[model samples]
Target: MSSLVKNIIRFILFIFFQHFVLDKISLHQMITPYVYFLFIIWLPFKMPRTWLMFIAFLLGFTLDSFRHQPGFHAAACVLIAYIKPFLVNMLIPQEGADTNYQEPSIKSMGGPLPYFIFIAVLCLLHNAWLFFLEAWQFGNIWYFLIKTILSTAISILLIFITELVFNRKQKFRTNTI
Candidate 1:
């Protein structure tokens, strides 16, 4: 029920789903849905940057171990983790940065707009970096761009569906003076 316990469970589940299920799905070899990054996005808003990066690295490394892709995933994860705070600040704004916001969700981050933007930017960045690294020596910019765009789109859709299905809106109480 606690944040720590919930996050631990999430970490495990995301990794399992990613490696065992999503990883096995080869959709035309271009649309690899990466819902694993959802774990990083779902982390508590107030979590320390160091811990966020560490967890992201761990998650990516674990995935790398399964997929045997060197450190591409790890690097992408760390990059996204590093920029997450800035993105959150920019998207949520000062007045909306409420302390009660536990994590980045449709309800917690306010409404669907901010939340959608937040997820889209992060997913795009992650997919771009990942596909760029994967296609580093290929020298085909068009290929890299196409793969990145397509993968990012699929990942974003999967993340949205997962959030809608699994995440529940937390009810908040307002005190009147």
Candidate 2:
């Protein structure tokens, strides 16, 4: 399928996975792993930073509306979205950037090592912000730390599995995407 088609499907599937699956399964005192942020991470390498922020806001806002969490997720998503390009540059070193990849993957990004680190950082950031906000009123440092680590691990594992499963092999070459 085309990159556009794959991205649309990725967006929808992630929403369903987050809202219907992950959101519904509350871990209570434990951590709740979220894989939905993959949508933001999987966007084309050369996509505009501004557009990434917009889509991140939209994605988080939609999830917040569904879960009635107001601006919490939206805020975190925007933060991650804003830094995505910078992080990608640092981690992947886009001399050729493989723009048509459509999603961040080992096959497209050149190897599994850099891609894994990139995904891990984003997952940790998303989980840390989310759990920190959720635990704000309570003010439990341990919970925040534990939740971040646990949730990040789970989310990263899921991301790895998803990447392995789909394993798109196409690469899009462009200037500094």
Candidate 3:
């Protein structure tokens, strides 16, 4: 399938899952496990950096509109979009890359280790920023820190599980990194 089609499908799924599913399944007093940012992670590495941030803003705004959170998600999403390329490049050195590839996964990354670690880092950053912003002004430092850690860990695990179950890499091929 074309990258455009894949991204469209992913966007739709993310909106539905985040709004109707994940958003509704919050753990009472705990932070929501937000795996929606994985959509940005799955985007092609070769996608234009500007377009990535634009789409990230759009995606976050769309989700915010649904949840009525205004600019919170938008800001977090833009941050994720902004840092994605650099994180990917760091995780998988460009000089070591063997092809003008697209998307991210064990296949495109030429190994499971780099892709998984790369995505984990990005997800951690994304969730930490998101939760911290939401918890801003709250004076309970321990609560804020623990919630961020728990929520971020849960979000990352959910993302990893979703990718493994979906096997998104089946659509991409990269023999070398």
Candidate 4:
């Protein structure tokens, strides 16, 4: 299947699973597992910045619509989408890199350590921005901090489990019109 088609399907499935399954499960008021961000993180390396942000916005907006929080998810998603390139560049060194790792995944990232770091950093960023925005105040800093940490850990674990279970290398073929 084409890359576009694969991504489209992934987008739908992630949103559906997040809203129906993940959102309903309340481990606590704080530690919510968010696998939806994985969709944005897994996007192709060569995707243009504008499109990436646009897609992130759409993904977050969809969740916002469902959850009744207007811009929290949208803003957080866009923030990570904006930072994704820099984070990938920082974690994946330029020396002797494999060009074929076109998307962010365990195989593409060389090993579990680097991939875990990448996911952890982004998950922390996402959870921090998201929970803070939801809180809308620094009055309870510790609350937000603990919430962010717990949520990030859960999200990272879920993401890794997802990667392991469906560990298929995606092949992207360019089409000529």
Candidate 5:
């Protein structure tokens, strides 16, 4: 149907999948692949920054409420939300950007390389903030680094897989009565 409808459904599905499936999978204490942030990352490019941040807050707060954490995800989500626009501008040059593309994706990003870079940087920042906040101490740098890196890698992998599986090439149709 419409893009708004699709995104609304996507938001629900991402929350359900993340909280039920992905969160339950514990490959290790240090590596939990969080693919939920993909929802925020995939939001329409034209969305206002304030609304983006608010939505990110809600997503993260919902997760925090589920997991019994105190704003770790919320903080990380806001961080990425705040930085996303700048990242988009930096990664996708105006001359090269496709105006028809509504959000960040491999196709919209022009290729796997730029998309990968975009995802990688955001995922890294997200994981780093999340793990650091969870730890709340710099007493163990290695612990933070290992956990952040592993989790970011797995999250990125899952995000890419999700994108490949679910990403659709949209078309606009005109109707005449």
Candidate 6:
């Protein structure tokens, strides 16, 4: 299947799962797991930055619609999307980066550490911005930090499990002309 088709399917599934399943699960007031961001994280490595931010905005806006929040998710999504390429470059490095990496899966990233760091950092940024926006008053910094940390941890776990379940190990190509 083409990357376009696969991404489209993933977009639909992520939205559906987030809205119908994850959003409904009230594990705690401060620990809502957000796996929808996984859709953005799973995008092809070379996708255009503009397209990445646009898609992230759309995904977040869609989730905001479900949650009845105005642009909160959109803001966080765009922020993380903006930082994703930088994180990828910093963690993976130019020499280690592969053009054929269709997605940021553990196998494609060559191991779990880089992939985990990539996802964990993005998740932290997303959750921190999200909770901060939700609590714009800045009433309690400690509470805000705790919420961000807990949510990020849960989100990271969900992302890792999803990658393990759905990501296939592809053989890396060595012959680069």
Best candidate (score: TM-score) = 1
Candidate 2: which stretches are off by over 4 Å? 1-5, 99-102, 172-177
Query: Estimated TM-score per prediction?
Result: 0.92, 0.88, 0.88, 0.91, 0.91, 0.92
**CA deviation > 4 Å runs, candidate 5:** 94-98, 137-139, 171-177
lDDT for position 76 in model 4: 94
Going through the candidates in the order shown, the clash numbers are 0, 1, 3, 0, 0, 0
Window of ten residues with lowest summed lDDT in model 3: 168-177
Superposed model 3: Cα runs more than 4 Å off: 93-100, 137-139, 169-177
User: Positional deviation of 25 in candidate 2, in angstroms?
Assistant: 2.6
Each model's lDDT: 0.86, 0.81, 0.79, 0.87, 0.86, 0.85
Q: lDDT by residue for model 2 over 102-162, one digit each (tens)?
A: 5567766668788888888888888888888988977999989988998888899988888
Model 5, backbone clash pairs (residues 3+ apart or across chains), number: 0
Q: Candidate 3's residue-wise lDDT over 1-177, tens digit each?
A: 777987899899999999999878858566668888888888877788899999999999999999877888888899989998888777775564624456677766768788778877777777777767877856566766788778878887897789779965454445555
79-172 per-residue lDDT for model 5 (tens digits): 9999999889888855536455777888787789988999999999999998888677556778899999999999999988888888577442
RMSD of each: 2.1, 2.6, 2.7, 3.2, 3.4, 1.7
Deviating ranges (above 4 Å) for candidate 4:
96-98, 170-177
Weakest 10 consecutive residues of candidate 2 by summed lDDT: 93-102
Model 1 poorest 10 in a row by lDDT: 168-177
